[model samples]
Target chain A: MTTSSYVYYPGCALQHRSHAYEVSNQAVAKALGIELVELDDWNCCGATEYFSVKRLPAYALVARNLALAAQAGTEELVVPCSACFLNLHKTDSHMRQHPRLEQAVNEALEAGDLHYKPGSVRVRHLVEVIINDIGFERLGQLVRRPLYGLKLAAYYGCLIVRPDNVLDDVEQPMLLDRMIEALGAEAAPFSMKTACCGGHMTQISETTALEMIHRLVTNASVSEADAMVTICPMCQLNLDVYQDAANRMFETSYTMPVLFFTQVIGLALGLSLEALGFGQEFVSVEPLIEKIRDVPPARSKPERRPKQALPMPAMPQ
Target chain B: MNATRPPTFFDRVVAATPDGERLSQCLQCGTCGGSCPSAADMDYTPRELFAMTMAGLEEEVLASNTPWFCVSCYACTVRCPQEIPITDLMYTFKQMAIEAKRFEHRSTADWSESFVGFVEQRGRSFELGLATRYHLFHHPAQVFKMGALGLNMLRHNRLALRPKSIRGIEQLRAILDRAKVLAEKEAWR
Candidate 1:
């Protein structure tokens, strides 16, 4: 049996912006006997821009971390942030394919007294690790309280699915949906699984960002999902914190809670809402909390009435 | 930056972009343009640019000043309903443009030159050198205004007066030269 242990790179957001993600991820991993080792002196993954701006430096930035992970003796690195995972994975792929880029980046690394050989460590998303390494069967076995009637819409976003190199099937990815179902919740059918959330666009431009967010939330809500479940911190923050603003911007009424997949796993493991960082969310999860314990009744159609009065009038005439 | 031979058209196209999918699935809903912070200020939309690229209207897309204006906030990529990687495409296009010598924003090129100079001299970015170069390029007057502040920062050891070179400067140069050659060849292809 492959033990559930891997190096965890929470990236920048989880460390500063979304502390709840980190706390919940750790608690859930610990409960599942998945040891998450933090990389020593790991720097930023350049937040998805540096590589595009300058290929060599971007490679160097990600390569520095890969070298650190290699030194830590971890064969695989588990990244929680979608952007970090993409950047790290892209760097690994590009370095192997482009020798000149690899040599240039390694030279930069040499300046910092660090060296990284291509394909030294495999970079993976937390969702991939949880779904592949920790099988759904094992997940179901660990579930202390099965969320029988809770409805969840799994949101994958773009980074994890697109480019197809670092991801699973782009058209239909069942990892998150499977995980949600394993937790004993009904995975609601929704179409915007691989859609973009207009990340940081919320900071740069609000109107367009809100619309993108609005579509995701409305789709999930219309699908009758109680909450939106996600794997990326950026996606979670965008959906959870920006839901109200997105609603106000679009002038629509939508009250949906965005919960991290780990948080849902934690809840299923009988962990308290506090430990899951449920209170830190901008949109109140109180309504979701109520639903968690009490499942809503299934919708039923009304019975049709008989048309006897019309027949009696016709006979009299 | 050292003067190098001009890149070929194909190399130019390849260098201008990061590795990613193109905008074949774009819905042309204008969401990317509408969401882009720089869209209001630019002549072309991200959708149009992608269309032109796919259509092989390379001259118009590459020659346009649109690529330089991208802030790289990834707003367009995120809001794209079709899941088109707009920002990455923009990056690729910009890189291709720079390598092809079609549209290198002088200001950004100057910054790149100064930054590379600093890195070649010092293993990492030197704050003073960076600030000096930035002021020289963007606003020379700011340097004079903050002279006293700059002296105070140096006195307090907040800024290093002498920039240190990386230990294997020769190897670093050789690596950079090889990258330049590869980029040139890629642009030509």
Candidate 2:
């Protein structure tokens, strides 16, 4: 379940916004005996918009990270943030397919006195690496305090399992499901699991993003999930930062705490809340932690399927 | 400016895109439109936008918020039966809008500009810097509104008040510049 080496790229979000994901990721990795070396001189992956506005600059920006990871002399680079993972992985795939893009990206890199080859370094998300390299069997072995009473909705957001995927099915991935099960927490039915979290749309148009977040938060709550576990910072940010805004917009109050997948892993390993970087969210985890601590471990109560259940409600216009 | 010029919107988009010809293959089915979370907000659903582009309604398409309304979620791109990279196609429309200077989605456009500028200048994003720039150009009043949220992030160490830049920033700037020049010469425009 342990590997000798893999490089890590925390991306822009982890440096600040999702610092907890970074901390908990490293803690979980260290406990699992895999040391993740940070990539040197990495730059932002252009996040969501740059690539759309200016094609060449975005590719060049992402390529810089790839070139550095390759320079670090590792075949596999593990990314904790899904946006970073997608940027790195998608760039490598594009470079391999389109000679023009490859030439342009590489030419841009030459200015930095750096160059990258297509497919030289493999990019894997931390969750995928955990589920694959460090098998769930060993991951389960590390759990000191099993999350017996917690229920989680594995939120994949838009980037992680998307246009280019290898770890799991694009629409209905089970990697996180298995992980939650291993830690003894129930993987609640996440019907809207693969839906978009509005990404940076919340920054530009809160009205539209609020609608999207409201759907996701409401769905998770209806499923009786305790927390929504996510693999991307953008998803966590939108869900947490805009929870109250969403509730206000929809005239519905829903409290659902979003946690990075690694945070859940850290909790299962019995690491301190401080070590996992908990209590740093807009929608506080304080109540959820208390509930988990005060309650005895209980089996997940599955929602009973109703016979001839009323038809699904139509989407609001 | 060039009323006498040839009708070239489709040809230009095709030449610029990796699979521009695929745009012609759209089944007129509303899968992209249906799957889009922001479709209700868009002036034209991606389906309608694609149709407009094919119809050579360049001015309307360029000025419309259809492209900017896209959050780049890729639900359409993933679910498209024709395997169209609809999101990237939307991105193409966004770039065209920016280049044409006919875009009306001021707030989104400002954010995109600020985001790209932040990446270019610091070799990484300064979250506060990006937000401040966006607010200045788009909605200065919202800056005060965001104070409480900003304080929460600041308290949690989610944002650093002073940006810590990455090493080799000059090289990053050079790469972006050179790539711009090279892309300009790609024979698409």
Segments in model 1 whose C-alpha atoms lie over 4 Å from true places: A1-3, A165-167, A294-317, B1-10, B16-88, B94-189
Q: Write the per-residue lDDT of candidate 2 for residues A1-317, one digit (tens) a residue.
A: 44566788888888888888888888878888888888887888898778768877788889988888788788888888877887788889978988988988898899989899999998889888889887989888888888877888988888788887667787898889889989878889889988999888877887899999999999999988999999988899999988998998889988899999999988888999998988678787877776564334666466777888778999999
Q: What ranges in model 2 sit over 4 Å off?
A: A1-3, A293-317, B1-7, B187-189
Pairs in steric clash, model 2: none
lDDT of 1 at B37: 48
Top candidate, metric DockQ: 2
Candidate 1 C-alpha lDDT tens digits along B77-179: 6557776666666666665565567633555444544555565454344546766776666666666754654565454334456554445455444544444
